[model samples]
Target: MEETYLSAYVFKYGLEKALKKTGNIEEVTSRMIRDVSGGVRVEDDISPEGLIWIDGDNFNTWLKPKIGQCQADGSFKTVYQAAEHVAPDPYSIYPSSGKCTADGLVGADGKVRKNVI
Candidate 1:
């Protein structure tokens, strides 16, 4: 969907701008631009019809819970809300194994406050 791409663009733009404040202005900005542009190109190359299948299947699998209470009045409440918002820290980005592990770059208010020792 166009909205999804637009949101990603806006988010990356803001994220890159924020990264500039941490030094390496040129490197960070250029790498972010290239990576985001490449991702967009790949997404754009997918046929619109392909999106129908991908999005349809993804919606059925992921969003089915949200629509469980649809009534004759066309109203429903959000039953499932994610308890945490996790975003990868750009400074320590790296690929991990299939186990979905991270290198301690995720930040949360309470998580940040905790100390191991």
Candidate 2:
């Protein structure tokens, strides 16, 4: 797998509140669902950091009460939540040498590549 990078943001309030204010949850949800299947690819060396939103269907519902500020009364202070099924980042899950992207994978030599998945 290739080494991908995604910048995460942490706000004073919980993820739910922050998303509601910024109105970025919808965009995130759409990208996660359509591109990464509601999850981000990771490996032993690579790990997702920060609060990830799970059970996010156009902000219809959130899986865990504490997403970002995982404290008392919806305080997402904790970075990681066990029950959250949300993805950390955007589309990723392809061989590093293939140069995979949102559209598909690309071979290093630029040949013999057509990812079905």
- Please report, as a residue range, the 10-residue window in candidate 1 with the lowest summed lDDT: 54-63
Error (Å) of candidate 1 at residue 62 is 15
In TM-score terms, which candidate is top?
1
RMSD versus native structure for model 2:
14.5
How high is the CA lDDT of each candidate model? 0.35, 0.39
Highest lDDT against the true fold, candidate: 2
- Report lDDT (Cα) of residue 106, candidate 2: 56
Please state every model's RMSD to the true fold in angstroms.
14.1, 14.5
* Model 2 lDDT tens row, 1-117: 112242122121234444554578755453333433222222224334433332222222122333464567863476755665433222235455465344444567776467545
Error of 1 at 105 (Å): 16
Query: Which residue runs does candidate 1 get wrong by more than 4 Å?
Result: 1-19, 22-26, 29-68, 79-97, 102-117
